[model samples]
Target chain A: MINSRDILETIRMIQDENLDIRTITMGISLLDCCCDDIDRSCQKIYDKITTKAARLVAVGNEIEKEYGVPIINKRIAVTPIAMLLASSGGDPVKYALTLERAAREVGVNFIGGYSALVQKGFAPGDEQLIRSIPEALAKTQHVCSSVNIGSTKTGINMDAVAMMGDIVKEAAELTKDDNCIGAAKLVVFCNAPEDNPFMAGAFHGPGEPECVINVGVSGPGVVRSALKKIPDGNLTDVADVIKKTAFKITRLGQLIASEASRRLDVPFGIVDLSLAPTPAVGDSVAHILEEIGLETCGAHGTTAALALLNDAVKKGGTMASSHVGGLSGAFIPVSEDAGMIDAAREGILKIEKLEAMTAVCSVGLDMIVVPGSTTSEVISAIIADEAAIGMVNSKTTAVRLIPAIGKDVGDELNFGGLLGAGPVMSINTASPAKMIARGGRIPAPLQSLKN
Target chain B: MRAVITVIGRDVVGILAEVSGKCSELNVNIAEVTQSVLQDMFCMIMLVDMDKCSIPLADFSDIMKKLGEKHGLSIHVMHGDVFDSMYHV
Candidate 1:
């Protein structure tokens, strides 16, 4: 028996509080598509993706209407292209073009997996693909790329970290006129997840199934609204509220994931328990932090609030869904999140503070726009800092810094839509050139160390 | 298949009759209906068996949406599983 209270609450969450499935990302394995010839590999890649995800968008729309819940994006994630490049041994850009075409053909908003995992060291095709990211991203419209340079068990790969600095800059420079959109699509990461359903960092890991459906859920507004109702609640009460709200949100994702999997006949993957925020007014993770007794998002107690929120979200979400993976926590992307945008523009949210928040939050240094004059070495140093956090803490952290080509601090770079806009925040200009130049692996930390 | 159709708006004449008429036209059998009038605002929840509906589920949703707009009410026809999955587990 369905109760009216639950039905009304669900409706309110969807209608007024901005509850929605962030994405239904179909993960397609391209291991079988690898070929010695580049063109043949590209052809196989395109055919496999188009065929597997042919009805993804249509099904997403049907589910959205039938369930009265909004499905924001129907996207795809594929096995890292570097493995295909390893066998094909040709222009990595060809794979990017092929992915863009497949995304267009299948009518998906984005296609992720132009990626390489050299967390410990460069593989056969890793370095080449990393170098071609700038050009590949500049040419393609819907393809997203990510590179993992470090992991907790293996430590940081300094060589790939240095190379990614140049790649990130080139990606920004190549698409300078288009709002540095290329940089927005490229992510440099430590401990990257292969099954992430989010854009700019999602890639189907080699271990994933031939084809699977992963759902990412979002609802910062719902959480905030719940918190607002209990204004006098203690810290424990805050955590409880978040847990209850997250349970409802994740259950929705689990339902959608299983249904989509049943219809598509693809194995259901994880339901990422992330509070992915949009540029919309109520849908901001930063605002949720403020609601949890903070003066502002980047204030003194910001990190502690974020930690509680992230932990409670996972605690609640884990019980709701059968399996949960991806970067399953509160995402604090500065540009894409409305509260972070306001705090950032007002200088309350500093890059250093964002770095600190990332230590406790899900992702790191995401959607931040810095001055174009910022050097590759500085970017590398930032990535190194983020990688260190992930390395020492045994968590996933990534850097997606967009260099506003001709814009200075206080200037805005607007990408429009879900990519949102950001004011060019200040960054440390001190030269880390020597540190970045001395490229060698940073050895792994002891796993059992306390305090 | 079962769906929960909820209509919320200012209290007006023939609200239930019109909604039932649309459902009957589409061969959707309503098993249970609960209506309330709170402070002059009308609220109704209808649990309908959608298996015998003539149109596809999505199309039926579209028709309900258009009908709601025409009558200036907020109408939502969502699958029962949404409420079940969320409220049960």
Candidate 2:
């Protein structure tokens, strides 16, 4: 027997509160697809991905219908393409094109893992792949790229950091005609997770299984609505409300992950208990913060508020799923959240404030647009600052800044749907050219010496 | 297998009969049903056994959705396991 109350609550959460499975990413390892010839490797990679993920979209649709939960994206992640590039040793764009073909063939929204892991230092194929990101992303429609340039165990790779600045800028410039969508598809990371299922940053790390299903759950609106019932609750009461809401959200994710894994016959990976927000009016994470009694999302106590929210979500979610990995925390992508966008447009939310917020949340400086004149060195410096935070705290942080070419402060680029639209926010123009020119790895902190 | 069907809309006569008629046509047994009328809005929750259902749950869900649309109601059909897994340990 099922309780009518629980049934109605579930329905309300889905229909009214905008609760959803953010993504069901199928991680397919392409190491076995590697070959000496680039073309041959591309073919093998395409064949493997298409064959493995052929039923992903169909299964996702079936589950969405049967469970009555919206699964927004059916995506695929592959082992970092740099490994395959090392063996194949040809123009890296070949792999990107092949990935695009496979994604379209299998009818997936996006295919990630056109990526490299140079957290320690660049390897044989790393620099080539890194340099080609701009062209590759500009050429392909659904391929996402990421580069791990720092880690807690092995300090920051300044060389890769510096190069990534130019890469990020070029990625945007190449696709400037299309709202700089290229740069939005690239992420530069520190302490990057091997099994994150979210896109623009998701890549099947080399450490992941041959093939697996990872799920990301989303419900900022549900959390906010839950908090709304207790308007005068103390901070203690607030955390409890958030934790309870997170528990319900994650249980649904665990159920969906298990079901998807069973249907696909792939190993179940993990449930990413993330409070990811969409541009929908009611689905903003910043609204949850406001519901927590903040004046605005980027106010003085914003960091403290985000810290509490992030911790409570983890505390509640850890017990709901058997395995919870990925960047499982509150996401505050500015353009993707309506509240954050409003804050940014009003100048209440600045880049520096967002940087501070990232230290307390899951990701770092995501989906921000800077002026066209913002130099590559400045972009590299921003990456360095974010990487330092992730390195010291032993957490994952990433930068997905779009240098909106020919755009300036107060201008806006509308990418629309999911990627959303971003106002061109102002950034400090002080040149970091001297510091960026001094490219060297920043040593790992004492936190890494635990052993 | 069992599913939960929820219909929410304005209160109207024959709302229950129309839904149950479709369920019976599909060989689905209505194990339990609960309904509430707040002012003019009506909401119903039905626990249905689909062990001997003639059509797939997905198809039945679509059919019910269309039926609800015809009457300006919102209907949802979900597996009982979804509720069980979420509400229970």
Candidate 3:
């Protein structure tokens, strides 16, 4: 029994509030596509994805019209190419190239699963894929790469964690044009959710259905507005007010996703109820913190405060939707979250503090801005540090640091709205590049080997 | 005597206020109530002390049934002991 007004407001959210089916990610397992011959496997991989995903865009568009909801991104996630390569004898770079070609042909914005789960440790093809990440991602526009270097169960695999520090630099150097956008597509995770439909973390799990639809709902603006209206500022009231507002917002997501799935004839994935902050002015996790009485975001009690916010959002969101997944927590991208930008400008938040906060949320250190002159090796070290956090905790984490050219510490570079602005944050003078520059695929963690 | 009322449908205008108003007129004291919207559909459960009510259970339940059907909702009336045994206890 939907109300006409609630229906109208839902429609308005789609038409204006940047609300869209964040991703219509089709997960295709490549197990059936595998063969001893590499080319045959590639052909099977290509055919399976393109054929299965052919109706993806049309279906998304139809739903947008019928329900007046917008579906923004259409994507595909294949079984890890590394595993496919184990039986199909081919060069890693060439295999990645085939994946990129298939993605372009399928017309999906991004195709994930150029990944390896090294949490416990890497398997056979993991080495080849990790080694070829820079070349593979650089060679193809549609391919997104992610590596799960740590998980809560196995703890952080420091050796593999050590190597990824350098891989990021190579990736950034390869895609220099999109403001080091290659690094933007890479994610490092702890307990990476198997059903995450968002890229660059999306990958078809061995256990997933061949094709499915998942909706990642983000509305930091809604939360911010609620926070802004609290006239009297008590920390207890702030938390209570946020909890109630989040309950309503998450309910909206659950309804929209359930309705969308019913109409599209696809099983609705999780209502990712993540408070994913954008560069939009009021729609930031950091801003919410500031509104909760922080003069600046990265102040002394920042991590504790953020942890509370992150946990509360999850608690309320889970109650709203049973099928919740995909980094269902607040996102604190430094460059993309406005509150983060101000904190960096005020010299309160730093890379180290953001790393500290990831222990409680899904996405790790994100949207940070480092000095452009900083070497890629150090950037890799940052990736490594963040990766370790994800691995030890078994949570999905990522790094989206921007190396703004000609900008030094304390200098602010604004990406403008939903990708807000970030101050050029200083890096540790004691560099890790020399250590990261060592280019071998670090041996798979010993714990990964089993009977 | 007691009666449990349940409303199952989508949330809309005046459902709670109007239904509660009827209960007030009948002198039925609401002991407990809770509601939630599940995937666009609303479900509510309410317990009332019908012993204090002026109207008979049949009359009060009749009013709820008429109002609910008018607004495209389904209404259910149950005895207090049955309602408590099934839901409360």
Candidate 4:
């Protein structure tokens, strides 16, 4: 049996290792809010949110107080607004603004639903929603966005794919000074989930109930610390140990979610059994990848190893929680995950290799640090490239690059705890700036219309 | 007309501050609270004191709605009697 102190130690690893739950998103269906009248529709959306999300942040805190475990984000996911308000016929931007206003009114940091589903083909509202990406994200302080351009089951939605390529570029242009921050607010997905609690990635699936609570489990440090105990452990045995550990870890999440739902009176939502990696030194998804056998972070076998690791953890967590969903895999965020930093220092991981890894697992390039000296055009180019992968492959992908204020390649800067330390990785410096400065929206690619 | 305040949101500034402010304004005492996040979403739970409160449940709910929207949130307030039976029972 895992000792009680071991549990406390797990909790401590999260604290000392800069680990915490990445998200605790409540899923609320907005189907009932659908209507032709803008005001009436707004009213329904507002009522549904306030009625269902009133105590969300508060209850989440109470649990934190008792367990001494921190929840980093308290958020909500509603039905894709496109599905609900597309029939407004024209100018979905205004409705999106209304949704943005309501999200502010309710007090959640980000409200995700400026979304569309073109996996098979574009829905009328999806086109409108896609067009609203740059404007909606730019105008609103807290409205995150996503587009499901494809899915594994559906293969890929070519048209949706093509459009998103341009959309990401547009969003990057809209928020160029903010680190091309708009791209951070959106994701392109394949086999998009209905009840992912993390965003700009989360959305209420059509199959979900009116309202439910979804939990995202994290503590890369806890897993990392556990690994330290068994240094040089056999790879096969590591899988068994990881499964048992994940079972207990996910059970704790299940308990917390169940208790929260029972106390709050909402139906219990699923547990997002994802080992969300953070910038903290001890809690790194890349560390797990390396421990599973890799000479460096961006080694040749990275993706195959990550896919296997994701599958094993899911098998373990599935046994732990019946209600599991969301992006339940190892998050390989370079700046935010500690192990990647070590690999970068060791000259083992490279930017291109990380890109290849994204083809398989982890939320696409996240918390990556590039030099401030790099031009905005290059940043936009990077965004376009990453989005292209997500769009064509039809999987959820995002980018959060920090253009370090005065940093250079081969130099390291520490963000201090949980945010993780980073090495400003080298970016191609051949002045792709000229190409990016040309800056017109990349037209929707021809591959976008498979459906 | 007892109610339960379940707060699920992120670890951001004033999540605790704003909710507590509302509870006190409504003359609702904080019976219990659990502020924590899971799955990248934050949440909390508070048992309100409606015994001597002058406001109606609907009014309290509206005040909550206004405050919640001002901050970009999704809030849900349930009657304690109803909440307990629905969830606990």
Candidate 5:
């Protein structure tokens, strides 16, 4: 039996608290689309993605209307273009253009997987794809790119890390006029998940099915609201409240994923148990931390609060859905979350503190904007540090930094919408040029030896 | 298929009659309804069977929403499964 209290609670969560399904990402494998000629491969890739995801947006809308829950983005993730580039052996930008066309045709908000996985070393097409990311992203509006430059098993690829530093700078420089949006669409990951449904880091890995539907659920505001009801509760009470709230949120995600999978006739993939926040008021993971008794998001003890919240979310979400994968925890994207943005502007959320938080949270250095004069080596060093955290901890971490080209530490770069406005956060300018120039791989950690 | 229709607003005269009349017009069968008045606010939750409705649930929801707007009420219609999945296992 359904009660009025439950129905009203659900309605309030949607209407006031901004509860939503962040995305319904269809992962399509482009491995079979590869051909000897670049044009033929592009054609095959376009046809496959367009056909596979043709009904994605429409079905997402139908579900949204029927369920009364907003599905924010309908996206597609394909096999990394680098693998196909190895076969086609031409300009990788062609694949980006094809993906953009397919995304526009099929009406997805973003098409991810313009990517390369060079965690150990650069393969035949890996370097080419990495070098072309700036041009590819600058040329296309709806395509997202990621490069996995390190992992626990293979360690950090310093050469790829160095190259990605230049690539991230070039991407931001190329799109400086558009609020440095190119870099916003590009992510550098360590231990990247294969079936992540979020962007700008989502991709269909080689291990995935030919076609699958993955769902990302979000409800930071709902969790925060639940905590507000327990103002004098102990820390354990806080964890229990978050666990119950996360369970409800993930159940909705599972329901929607199953419905979409059944409708699209594609296999159902995991439900990413994430608390993804937007710039909208009342929708922030940072606010959840504050609700846990922090003066601000970057205050001391913020890491402990985040660690508790992330663990509780995963614990509750694990039981709600049969399959839980991807970066299943709290996402603290500096720009996307309203509370984080305010904290950044107030100088409370420093980059170093964010790096520490990433050790406990889901992603790392996400949507952070640095000064234009900051060198590529600094960005690479930042990636190395974040990658080291993920490599050592054996968790997924990513860096999506925008070099606010022609902008300074205090200036704000507004991309609007879900990408949000990034306040240019200060970076340490001390050079790491020599370290980056060494161009050698950091050996895998002892944690990787369990196999 | 069944849906949950919730109407919330300031206490109004004949709000139930108005809503149930629309359901009858659309051939939707009302399975259950619960209403309460707290102070000056009125809240109602209705479980309606839409398997024999005259219009699609989406369209029916829009119609009910428009009707609520005319009477200054907040309205929402969602699949019952959303509630079952969230509140239940």
Candidate 6:
């Protein structure tokens, strides 16, 4: 028998605490859509995505209304475009335009997979796609792009890393008039997941099934509220609370994923157990860290708190869902998170401290706005450092930095919406150019021999 | 399919009658109902069978929400699976 207390608790979590499904991403494999001619491939890609995700938004709405749970974004991730580019030897921008059009027509928020995987080395179409990312991102509105420059097994590709710095700079410069929005849509990844449901890093890996429905579950607000109730609890008790809260959140995600898959006649994919924060007050991963006995987020003990939170979330969420994948942990996007924005604006959250936090957090240096004068070499060096951590630890890490063109540390760039405003955080002016100039792969670390 | 309809507001006469009357008009069968008053504020939970309802789930929810607005109460109709998946293993 269901009790009133349990029902009321669930209702409060959804109504007051912002518990929500962050996205219902349909991953469609475009491998079979490849053709010799570029236009033909574009047409095939458009048709496949449109047909596979035709009812995605409708199904999401139905589930949302029925369950009284908000489904935030209905998105689609396709097989990385580099594989398609290898067969259709032509301009890759055509693929981006087609994806943008399809996204608009199907009424999805974002269409990802304008991407390339050159983590180990540049394949036939890898370099070409990476080079064209700036143009592709600048021209499209709803399309997201990503590039994998490093992985744990294969190690970091320094050549691609070096190119990405310039690519990010060019993207920001091209869209400078629009708050450098182009760079906001690009992600440079280390050990990028094959089935991430979040953007701007989600791309359906080549190994993914033909069509699948993946759900990303989020509730930083719920976790924070739980923590607030046990203010004097010990560390173990805190972890227990987080675990229980995450379990409930992931159960909802599992329910929605199954419902969406059954309705769309697609295979059910993994549920990403992520505490994704938003610009809304009381909805922040950083706030959760603060609730865990920190004066503020980015304080000295932030990394350790984040490490505990991430592990407990996985422990609880793993049991709730049949399969848990994607970057399943706490996301600390600077701009999109209200607590992070406050911490950054007050100079409490430095870039280096955030970099250390990323070693334990789910993603790395995400949505950080650096000074426009900061060099591309600096950006590349940041990526290399982050990739090294992920490679050595065998965890996923990514970098999504936006250099605010013609702006300095004190100024702010407001992109509005989910890509919330970011206060330009200062960077170390000391050049890492000498190290970044050494453009060669960082060989994979020894996995068997633990030091 | 069954749904849980929750209504919370100031205690008043005919609150239950108005809600049940709307359900009867839509051919919805009420499986169970529980109501209580705390400090003159009313709270009610009604489990209704939606399988034979005359209208779609979305339409029915909107209609009930509008009815709640007319009566100055907060009403939410949601599928029972949400509570089951969340509260139970």
Instruction: Go through the candidates in order and give each one's DockQ.
Output: 0.88, 0.85, 0.02, 0.03, 0.83, 0.78
- The lDDT of model 4 is 0.68
Give residue A52's lDDT in candidate 4 (0 to 100): 86
Compared with the true structure, the alpha-carbon lDDT of candidate 5 equals 0.95
Model 1 chain A poorest 10 in a row by lDDT = A442-451
Order the numbered candidates by DockQ, best leading.
1, 2, 5, 6, 4, 3
Report how far residue A226 has shifted in candidate 2, in Å.
0.3
Shift in Å, residue A409, candidate 4: 8.5
lDDT of 5 by residue, A1-451 (tens): 9988899999999999999999999999999999999999999998898889999999999898888889999999999999999978998999999999999999999999999999999888999999999999999999999999999999999999999999999999999999999999999999999999999999999999999999999999999999999999999999999999999999999999999999999999999999999999999999999999999999999999999999999999999998999999999999999999999999999999999999998888899989998899999999999999999999999999999999998899999999899789998999999999999999999999996
Our model 4 lands, by Cα RMSD against the true structure, at: 11.3
Ranking by TM-score: 2, 5, 1, 6, 3, 4
Candidate 3 has a DockQ of 0.02
**For every model in order, what is the iRMS?**
0.6, 0.7, 16.7, 13.2, 0.7, 1.0
Q: A103-194, model 3: which lDDT tens digit per residue?
A: 88867788898887776666877877887887887788778888876665566555566667567766766766645666666776766777
Q: How far is A413's C-alpha from truth in model 3 (Å)? A: 7.4
Chain A, model 2: TM: 0.99
Predicted model with the maximum lDDT:
5
Candidate 4: stretches off by over 4 Å: A1-11, A292-295, A341-348, A359-451, B1-89
**How high a TM-score does candidate 1 get?**
0.98
Judging by DockQ against the true structure, name the best candidate: 1
Which has the higher TM-score value, candidate number 2 or candidate number 6? 2
Give a tens-digit lDDT track for model 2, residues A190-303.
Answer: 999999999999999888889999999999999999999999999999999999989999999999999999999999999998999999989999999888988888988889
Off by over 4 Å in 3: A1-21, A259-266, A372-381, A391-394, A402-423, A431-451, B1-89
What local lDDT does model 2 show for residue A339?
A: 93
